[model samples]
Target: DTAVSQTPKYLVTQMGNDKSIKCEQNLGHDTMYWYKQDSKKFLKIMFSYNNKELIINETVPNRFSPKSPDKAHLNLHINSLELGDSAVYFCASSRHRAAGVNEKLFFGSGTQLSVL
Candidate 1:
C-alpha cells in the first residue's frame, strides 16, 4: 500500500488555464507539505500545513496555492497557469518533531504538470 498518494499523476494544459492536484497520506502524520521540482531537478517547498493549519509558506508565486482539508490531505491549485509553472509537484508528510538525526520527508508519488 502507498503511504502517500496524489491524483492526476500527469497534467497537460495550455498557459492561462487553471488546474488542481490532490494528495492524501495514510502515515498518520500531522504535518503535510507541497513541493515543486523543476526540470533541473531542483526541489523546493511551497507550503506546509500542520493539522489543517497553514504553517509554512515558502514565498511561492501568488498564483500557486495550497489547501489542506485535514492533516492527511493537501491540495494544490494554480490559477492562470504559466509555462514556468510546469514542474513535478510532490506532496509530503512528517511528524513535525524537533530536529533529529533521522529527520526526513515522506513524499508522494508526484504530479507532473505541463503547461504549453
Candidate 2:
C-alpha cells in the first residue's frame, strides 16, 4: 500500500504535446496539493484542493490544470507542453487543518517531465 503514487516517473516529450500525470493517496486526508520543482530546486505550490474544492492557485499557466475526483486523488493535465514546462511535479496530501493550519504534507516521489 502506497501513501501516494505517481506513474511515469520520467516523462520526455517534444513541445506542443499534451500529457497527464496521475496521482493517488491512500491516506484519508481531505487536502491535496500539486507542486512544481524547477531546475534550481525551488519548490513552489502550483495548486491545492480541499474536498474537491480548489483552495489555492499560484498564477500557474493555464496549460497546467489539476483535477481531483475525490479527496484521495488529484491528477494533473498539461496542454501544449513546452520546454519551459520541464520540471519535477510532486503530489502531496495533508489532513484537513484545524483553523486552516494543516499538518505535515505527505509527498509522492515525483514525475520528471522533460520537454524538447
Best by lDDT: 2
Off by over 4 Å in 2: 97-102
* lDDT by residue (tens digit), candidate 1, 36-66: 9999999998998989998889988889888
**In lDDT terms, how accurate is model 1?**
0.90
Candidate lDDT scores, in order, read 0.90, 0.92
TM-score, every prediction:
0.94, 0.94
Encode model 2's per-residue lDDT on 28-105: one tens digit a residue. 999899999999999999999999999999999999999999988899999999999999999999888433554788
Q: How many residue pairs collide in each prediction?
A: 0, 0
Runs in model 1 deviating more than 4 A are none
RMSD of each: 1.2, 1.6
What is the alpha-carbon lDDT for the whole of candidate 2?
0.92
